[model samples]
Target: MNNQASRSPVFKAMLETEMEESLSDTIKLSDVSHGALCAFVDFLYTAEAPLDDDMACDLLVLANKYEINHLKNYGENFLISKLNWESSLKNYSFAHQHNAKTLLDDALSLILDTMDNLNEREEYLELVEKDPRLVVNIYEAYYSKTGRCCRCHQS
Candidate 1:
């Protein structure tokens, strides 16, 4: 593959390097699933890939890892389009982990909008246990959005 076809710096660097994969006829991505690899390759060639709810996150991850800006944006937009209250927390966490700022903001907005019932949800409790900082971030976001501190209503 030539540099003109792909916008990914990772691919450009790999192709330019004297690395074994560059010299060899094959390049193996052990962590990527066959379907994801196929889709990633297809995107590199065509600048497009069919994305479903299940595939979007995976593609986003691959896009991020490979530093494919357009593909990453595509996946982030797809995930944002699919966002809902039920999946907001999970998506928010995924976005944070993946450094998808737009997706993170969108998911955080949904979570904040539903904050009245957030504590009652099992996911909220799980997040509290698994990543308390995320829950703190939610509260901080809430305060930032509302312009009110959590301590203001104290008795």
Candidate 2:
């Protein structure tokens, strides 16, 4: 892709720096899904993508990787709209992984709102086993909202 066609700062910078020498002119995005890369390129060209829940998650990762703030925000909003009890923990983890603070906080809030039954879910158990730190963070957030420290229970 030409530098002008790349709206992403990361991609644009890479193209500018790497294309200067031009022994080979290819950007390898091995980690990004085919669908996400395609949608990202389409968005860079036309400012649009056929976003859905699955695509939004994939696109968010691509957006974050490329430092494309507009597409990142779009992906965050789409994920927020899809959030619910069933998707909270997964979204929370995904948001954290992608450095999407807004989505992470929103998902955490929903998890706290339903904290009474959160542990009953299979996902919760799986999360606790896979990443105990995240479960601890959830409790920390819950206690903070109630005006107490999780460690000492002080106001």
Candidate 3:
């Protein structure tokens, strides 16, 4: 377990440092769910996990946190494969939060493609309320792509 887990830069650093966790037999991760933890450990050992949408999201977070590039890429690819109009906004938000560049780009493309109905979605409203900067980024992407202003729709 130590050998496999050390493949992550986070675990490697933790184990190498003279910190309490380095001397301890058990380490605690409070933020992640039990299932995600298990899957993350399993992936460390086996290089794969049974990825669903929720698991992909969880693993993506974990992988990013731990600097596990392979696992992060795996999770991103899974989510990207499942991208759609209904889930694009939510996925975009998640991708943005996690700094998943490919997933963010893919989700943003979908959101841009469906901008006409963007205001109808509850997620869009929530995102506007919660992270309005992200919404502005959407408009910026639109303007950049189309060479037209978001409000006036003129180049």
Q: Considering every candidate listed, which one attains the maximal TM-score?
A: 3
Residue-level lDDT of model 2, residues 1-155, one tens digit each, is 77533677776676667464233566777898888889988887777899999999999988888898988998999999999999999999889889999999999999999999997999999999988999999998899888887779788
Return the TM-score for each candidate structure.
Answer: 0.91, 0.88, 0.94
**lDDT per residue as tens, model 1, 1-155:** 66532487876777678977577734567898888888888888887889997678888998899898898999999999889999999999999999999999999999999989998999999999988999999998898888886788432
- Number of the top lDDT candidate: 3
Off by over 4 Å in 2: 3-6, 18-23, 149-155
Error of 2 at 154 (Å): 8.3
Worst 10 residues of 3 by lDDT: 19-28
For residues 39-88, write the lDDT of model 3, one tens digit per residue.
98889888999999999999999999989999999999999999999999
Where in model 3 is the C-alpha error above 4 Å? none
lDDT for model 3, on a 0 to 1 scale?
Answer: 0.91
**Clash count list over all predictions:** 0, 0, 0
TM-score, predicted candidate 1 vs. hidden true structure = 0.91
Better of 1 and 3 by lDDT: 3
